[model samples]
Target: MEVAQVLHMNGGMGESSYASNSLLQRKVLMLTKPIMEVAVTALFSTGATNFPASLAIADLGCSTGPNTLFAVSEIISIMIDLCKATKQEPPEFQVFLNDLPGNDFNTIFSSFLPGFQEKLRGQIKRKDGAWATLPCFFNGVPGSFYGRLFPRESLHLIHSSYSLHWLSQVPRGLEGNKGNIFMARSSPAEVLRAYYEQFQRDFLTFLECRGQELVVGGRMVLTLVGRRSDDPSSKECCYIWELLANALNEMVSEGLIEEEKLDSFNIPMYNPSPKEVQTEVQKQGSFSVDCLELSEVNWSVVDTEFNPNVASKDGGYSMAKSVRAVAEPLLVDHFGEEILDEVFKRYKAQIADGMSKEKAAFVNVNVVILLKKIA
Candidate 1:
């Protein structure tokens, strides 16, 4: 499958859109805020005396919505505060928001930019209390980050959140992974190897490409879904997919979806362990891992926080919508648009039942890493 063409969060501001269901992602960003602040502070402190006139920043996998400019806004706020503290002029900002070509860049440019600019202006003020022109420019670059997306050494800082778990394409040699849409307990050993190998290849390419784009002292803050255990089939990462597969299988049995289609389909995603990520960075040899940490967020808890009304009705409803916003486009591409409603309906029921039986929170494991280009 052409991941760039098919892999995108559901767009528009409807009820099921990513824009509405991305509170989970926003929570992840908030969780990593301290790390991001430190990374930015270090970048400036290393070159406190000689600052660039223009600062280049990129946000990879920046899907449209409220979360689109969330991190960039925080970074700019921190930078502006740092400038004030040091009595130095803040540099002109060239911010590149990146995602696949299919991403809804229109929403970002038309709906978000105006308010974002106004908010920035309000934050940046001169000594005489007049608004200072920070000269922040916004550009949307459409492409996969696994490949070259920027000119050599053009970026000063890069931030990616809740991306990178998506592989560039489905792993080759997954024929044995029948009845599974991702890494699962029932998957064969070869299936496990295939997924890991694919992650390694994609991640190394990501490192190599970003290494060429970031300046010598540039830093990167990346947060993505991950697992704590070395076992690829661990529940923290694989259980959600397994539950999803169960829902699909029920459809196949009921003649709603073809069994062959189910067998052929696999989500082009893998949640790596911290070790796996560190190993790839070491192998790539382009950047040093400054900080790597793992954290888990209970889906039920997040739902309660963000969608209390819906959560009160059915805990699975909100979580289901969140997954649908991210996975619907891919499902539509593979299964045709006909099965989406039934698929997610069954999937939601499955999640509700699974959560009840497990008695433990349904959590998404996340890995946050800080990297600096080797100078």
Candidate 2:
């Protein structure tokens, strides 16, 4: 937990990413499939823990929403089926739904179905009551995982998505960017080196946390964006986010925004390669990759679909909607909401103008590395 010091929450890292998260559907799909296998394999793994009784689970960085529960729901669904097939008692369950403080835990917890109570009751009625009376409850632990958030060897399974790349802190030597260091990409080797070093550190801490928290042979599945290739110049493959960030910075020079605010508003994307992922896990000493999935999904121009509230006029991806989703609150944080409308107007055309069906075929980077804590 060396990252506990700098990687701890400084500000805004936990803010709402859902507003423009429409692009997450494809990544989520890719992430969910392999993990279904992991859940099933865990049930049958020779080293597997007893059914249901040993199934305490946690979704790290599970931002407050039903959306974050996609893997949670699917895994539980598979586990339930396994229980029925084995004719064995369901395992005791404890689900820790965690996130940063700025997350919406209240919204998430309040939405749990009453059937969950029935689910517990059903597991309890098992001939073996240990499966039922197990501590199958939900907890909202809000803070950086860089600090030891859970007790040692407590979790049986863990899942995280699109979250790991965020460095616990902006990299060192980014003093020029101040607290806004990770908001976008950089050209200098030091910037990229610092970013990678921070990830290695934060990732090492994450593995250390998992090492202490997971059971012998306990499992985990982590999915996040990554670079498609090692060649840095591949337009289709490398650094699409940097292009977007530059677009954002251009808007700053147009007198459309403030320099300080723009610089502080980082994109926080990570593009670790598959090899890098494998290396990071192996360095942790107790985990091994089960599967690493890279997924690519497409979008259509005629789709014209956008969430109603924040959507733009007529149709298409609303720069106002997209930018303001991050920028509005951001600018308002530094300046004031007084000019939110103006700022949106200033940059609306810039974002839309860049969206071409042939050129920028919008896509997401989903890297799912399934791991087993083999002690």
Candidate 3:
């Protein structure tokens, strides 16, 4: 893989969206409540399958932040609830947080250690009357999710989020010399094909790993972007890739840049559809879908013209701005930080202020799917 692509995720910089997403767990939990109800019910009802006095749990792609331990916490909360209902022993959880090798293990371990210790003490008090215990022995396994990251049937429940859409590579066949149909233009057949192809490959691998890690009756949740192709537009946070595209087009119209460069730029993100996602999950053949729902939580209502304008106020930063926030940084890594940060700052300001003046768009897509390990 190219260095630009490798650095695209901002390895070790502690500045990726994952680091800043404090609301990710709450938002995810909110969107997942319905599915959780189903999964938890199935687990509890299956003859009250009692876990170890301590349960083993894992969070995949546990990015370097507070959100990684959520799977463990959530499981603890639910298991406690189940204990009350069934009057059976609650499982003491042995939590493992996993991520890529380059992940911020120090930060993750530090943040969770203090709280983890306390939780362990609490567990002892609850179960044995007095306290003085090593909380749920928390540890880190830093590695990619593409292959086995745990012992067979080692985890009772597994959780992953938002990280899966990233394909290992920009889809091939989009390049002209590669002889696929995608040319330097928007909506090219080959462009989308390559994108979906990568998605399919990676998504299936995710399900396969999930299939492997989960115990026979265990369940998992997946949340990702599911878009409506006809809409062809999205605006989330202060970052609006498509709207910025329109601004760039405006700059081009005013002779600021050549039109030839348009196709060279893309959103650098992929939003798959619910149908497409279902197709991939079904293809994996190891999990059965228990719930499928979509929420436009990241979406905001914007001026109607934002869709058709394609060359004026797209309600976000201009392509010129994005060149700084994204392209510039990718080209000159060390020098591009200030430039990208400045560009994003301005873009953010524009969204906040312009939205006050106009309706602004909402670009949230929270897809919550609960899958049972049928394999």
Candidate 4:
């Protein structure tokens, strides 16, 4: 299935909605604030001499949430500060928020826009006698970032967070990938090869597409899930799936779901190493990789509000909610909605047990990269 047809962060502000359950993504964005500021500042520093009258910025894979607007605001704020520091007038801003077509854009537009526009309007207000205007406009562009989603050389700064690890679709030949819904330590060599190849194809295409859309010297800042180890089966990256598979297997034993269903499922995601990302960037040859840095967070540290209620056996439920917010829609499509609660109930128990043994946590590594389109 085309991911654009099925994949989206859960919509709206409901309990399981992406809007309410996206604290982890928010943390990832906050952690990268310095990098974002630095990249935007550097873009204007060298390119200000020929700066366009209007700045075009797109946040590709920008799933709807507070984080999306937070990113847009941060980028615009940095640009404004840089302009003031350089004694140049701030350019009118054209901001594009890109995501899959299935994303909850109505919630984003209805709830997020009024505040965002209000902020922009305030930025245009001047203290001095003379009136000045810095117009900033927001538009939603729905599509997969793996292919062309913008016009040629139309963007000046592009940003994405917590999104690129997702492949365009699940890799083929997963029938051989017995007992797992995602790549795991036990996955066959062929299954591994299929995933690696898909990521290679998807990511390079992403670079090539953006390369065409971004002006020469345009900057891009991307933060995605990644692994620190060279090993593809590293615990840091694959453990979550391992635990998830365990829950599925338990359900199978209880005859709650067909065993074949479990065997046939595979997740369309990859946690690439820094070397892997660098190789693709070098191979594509459209952008110069400026910085590749890794930052790690424990699942337990992601959201204080969602922390486990140890007294109530809620140890791993927060992590489960975070994962479900992203994965439930896909799982529901495959296994049917009737099994959703029960499946995660088993999953929460499994996660709690794993946490009890030795603090089970995600790799939660962010591969932060800054690239500049080569002229």
Candidate 5:
């Protein structure tokens, strides 16, 4: 499948839309907020006199929803507070929200931006009861981040949350990867090698592209799903896909899906270890890692004090909805839309059973890295 064309979070504000099901990603963002704050603060602390008059920021893979603007808002708020504390005028803000072309940019532009701007203006109102007019401009750029998306040296601060794990495309030559949809314990050595090689190429290209786009001393903070273990097929990263494959195999047995279809499909995602990511950054030679952290969040953490309405009596259902929001479009493109509900129904049951038996097994490992452009 052409991943760029097919891969997008389920759009619109429906129950199954990514906007509703993105609590996990939102939690990850909150967990990494301090790292982002530090990155932005460090950017200004390096040379306050040299701070740009118009600061440019990009949030890559910024899918539409509450989470889309969450990080951007946090970054801008940090800068505003820092400027106030340091007694410096805040720079005019230029914000870019980027994702694939198939993303629901309309929801963002029509439903969110106006309110965001109004609220931002209210926040920056002067003590004299006049508007400070911070002059923040928001633009939507649609494309894959695996390639160049901006003018050379145009960005000052870059942030991406829970997005980098997606490969540009499914790896080539995965005939040996029958019955499984992604890297799993049962996958062959060749299957593992192919996935890692594909990630290396894609990640190196990502670093190189951002290297070209970010000015010297610019900062980037990236948070993506990753595993702590060096083993590529560890359960922390691949078990979800394994459960999904089991669901598909069951359908195949029931003749709801053809065996050949299940055999041919593979998810275009990779959860790299911290070592893998550090190795690639060293190989790319464009940015210096300032901070690297590995963290974990329970898959069953559907409800929190921050969002009481998001709770689920069925943890499996909550997890299934999250996966469906992100994977349904890709699954529909490949397997036909008729099987979606049943597939997820079975997948949800599998998750519930697995979680009940082994509650500790259901955690998502995440990697958050702060980098500065040095070259």
Candidate 6:
């Protein structure tokens, strides 16, 4: 599939929209809040008088949701607090929220932006002379973050969360793999090489682009799904796709889907290890890694009203909804919309059964990095 066109979070605030079904990603945001605070504080502490008159920040791969606003708000709040603590006049904020061209920007602008702007207006500000309403401007920049999106030396900070695992496109030379949508335990060695190589290329390009856009001392804090192990086929990274492939295989056996279609389908995603991320950053030769952390987030605990006591279909359903919101558009584009509900229903059932029988604890091992641009 043409990933950029097909791979968007479900639009509108309907039941399946990303806005409604993004509790998991929201939890991730919450978990990473402290990291953001530290990053923001460090950003301001980098020589008080060495700052620009205007601070430019971009949240890359910022999908439409409460999480998106939450991030920007957190950074703004922290920056303001830091400025006051340092007894420095706060710079005007230029914030950019970026995602794919197909993202639900209408909902973001019409529904979320107003409240965000009003909240910023309400924050008690330090008496920076002649300042009004905190002088923060928010704009939506729609495009892929893998390439250039900002002018040279325009950004002071860049942030992304729960993104970057998505490759620019599916790895090539996978047509020979039959009946697999992702890297499996049984995948050939060359398939793994193809995926790793693709990630290397794409990640290097990402750093190179950001390197040009960020000022000399600018920082970036990013959190993305990654693996703790060097092995790419570890369960932490591949189990979700394994379960999904099993669901599709069942449909193929029942003659609900053609087997060839299943074979041709592949997801454009990669979970890099911290070492892999560091390697690319170093190779790109533009940024110094300040901090790198790996944390495990349980799939079952990712909910708005998570009850640890209840391991029921409800949890399974919640997980399925979260995944569906992110993956449904691509599935619909490729398999037609008719099979969408049934497919997720089966996926939910499989998850429920797996959790009940094995007490399966699926996790996303995430890597949060803070990088500083080097001259």
Best by TM-score: 1
lDDT of 5 by residue, 238-333 (tens): 888899999999999999999999989999989999889999999999999999999999866645444445444666877899899999998999
Give me the displacement of residue 112 in model 2, in angstroms: 5.1
CA lDDT, every model vs. true structure = 0.90, 0.58, 0.57, 0.84, 0.90, 0.84
Which residue ranges in model 1 land beyond 4 Å of their true spot? 125-131, 359-361
Tens-digit lDDT string for candidate 3 (8-73): 322232433343423423455566666666666677677434555666777776665555665566
The window of 10 residues in a row where model 3 has the poorest summed lDDT is 176-185
Tens-digit per-residue lDDT, 109-212, candidate 6 = 89998898877776743334334667778899988888899999889899999889999999998876677788888888888889999999989999999999
lDDT of 2 by residue, 120-149 (tens): 457546634545453456678888866677
Model 6 alpha-carbon drift over 4 Å, by segment: 125-132, 304-313
**Pairwise TM-score winner, candidates 3 and 4:** 4
Q: Give the TM-score of candidate 2.
A: 0.77
Worst 10 residues of 6 by lDDT: 304-313
Q: What digit string (tens of lDDT, one per residue) describes model 1 on residues 162-215?
A: 999999999999999999999999999999999999999999999999999999
* TM-score result, candidate 3: 0.74
TM-score of 6: 0.95
In model 4, the worst 10-residue window by lDDT is 124-133
Q: How much is the lDDT of residue 21 in candidate 6?
A: 84
Prediction 5 global C-alpha lDDT? 0.90
Q: After superposition, how far is residue 187 of candidate 2 from its true place, in Å?
A: 1.8
Candidate 5: give the clashing pairs. none
Off by over 4 Å in 5: 126-131, 304-312
